[model samples]
Target: MSRPFRSVLYIPASKERALEKARELAADAIIFDLEDAVAPDEKVAARATLSRFLAEVDYGPRLRIVRINGFDTEWGRGDALHFGALAGVDAILVPKVDGPADLDAVAALTGKPLWAMLETAKGMLNAGAIAGHGRLEGMVMGTNDLAKELGSRFRADRMPLQPALGLCLLAAKAEGRVIVDGVYNAFKDEAGLRAECEQGRDMGFDGKTLVHPLQLPVANEIFAPSPDEVTLARRQIAAYAEARAAGQGVAVLDGKIVENLHVAGAEAVLAKAEAIAALAE
Candidate 1:
């Protein structure tokens, strides 16, 4: 079964407490951030700490990803080399990824799956090429950096970022790669966070990157199939089965046609839900 990567939580490498607390969180993945989260002087120490943490922690079934410094930085190579050596490390997240060359360079260096963070205008423009690059497992929306680079204000519906978002989704879907939406900066605004999570789900994101623990529930709720949806999916599967037994080629349920494609989609949803529930238990 494909692992469920529904809620990705970012923890600062320098914040030991936050890193420790991650063990108790329900996020599907934990991103050990060494770029924007660490100061220049703290980079060396954070790398050491993160290296030790990765070597020691089990992180249960949650995927472990390290967000290394941009490849252009002085400490980028060091961070990549150290974190890439860990046994449990699932993927390396490369920040400010501009093109396929950047992704290829990192993938070659680490020999691990690379998640390219599209955070700039150049990155957005070349998203398709980057997603198609070798060893690229996914692309992440870096909304804050994209907004800063474009000098555009944020809106509730993300009108300014629609094109970029759509492009990333298209490329990711084409390559069968995961696409995670960016974090909502406001940790205390639960309502706003939920709204944005719902919007991300509606926009075809596989999941969302979260900055705080409170956002975990919202992300999980938004990404997981709802009760009504699950019921409908179940009905679709049953209808298809009954039709096939009756030697009927076409099946209709609730005035809508149910084909192989619909049955496959419903099965996928049910499979994911079952996997998540099994993991929780």
Candidate 2:
């Protein structure tokens, strides 16, 4: 089945206003953060706050996720254990995931779908194995951590991370799992944000992990099928249908061969667009 998980927004667990604001946002998923966002002294309080909020809030149809700290950290394990039994959490985002073992350990702790973060060098190297892990639901790119760990400069085009990005995409696609792009750090530059969102879309991400509400619209717009694209997809499907009725295995559309594979691709695009449109209504 096609899951609508576009525009995943990150809401810091320590920020009450941010958590409340998520209820009113149009994100398809909300990632409640217990790592990076909270200070060392605030970890305990943050976990309690997140648990209480999750237990009490009505998140409607939006998927609720919690980004726990790395398994190596005490705070991370504590965050996972505290909310692992909570009812509303749809998935647990495990950072610094290096291999299948990490996923296995988390799955053992909670049956919740694991959204493994491909951040470190080891994680990138083992992306295929990690994605193939039995209980993984998806993969999220942790570009900032990855950049730091790899000692790579962040170019505007993200040239340094291309290999890692491709590996994550290949692994996720092979396993039939959702793949989301990393957050664009520049929240204030709307134009730059939109450009990066478009870049992520071009790279074949299912959606983008957003750090701010303003980024939501850009990610949604970039990921959503354009009117022209939808029209062409429909045309391709109809042409393929006519060809099939005539006992032909392939047909020519816009000077390109339209086969069963092409028809399936077109239909998938239409389905994704329809699902996204339905969410708006």
Count of backbone clashes, every candidate in sequence: 0, 0
Give lDDT tens digits, candidate 1, residues 1-281: 38777899999999888888898899998889999989999999998888777778778889888999987999988877877777778999999998988877776677878889999999888988988887988778999999998998989888998989999999898888989999899989999898888899998898999988988988998899888988999999999999999999869999999999999999988988887897698
lDDT of each: 0.88, 0.88
Worst 10-residue lDDT window, candidate 2: 1-10
Prediction RMSDs, each to the true structure? 1.2, 1.2
lDDT of 2 by residue, 1-281 (tens): 37666699999999988888788899989999989888988988888888888888888778899999877888867777777878989899998899999888788788788899899999988999999988889899999999998899978889999999999999999999899999999988889888888888888899999899988888888888899999999999999989989999899998999988888889888999888877777
The worst-scoring run of ten residues by lDDT in candidate 1 lies at 79-88
Displacement of residue 39 (Cα, Å) in model 2 is: 0.7
> Residue 72 of model 1: what lDDT?
90
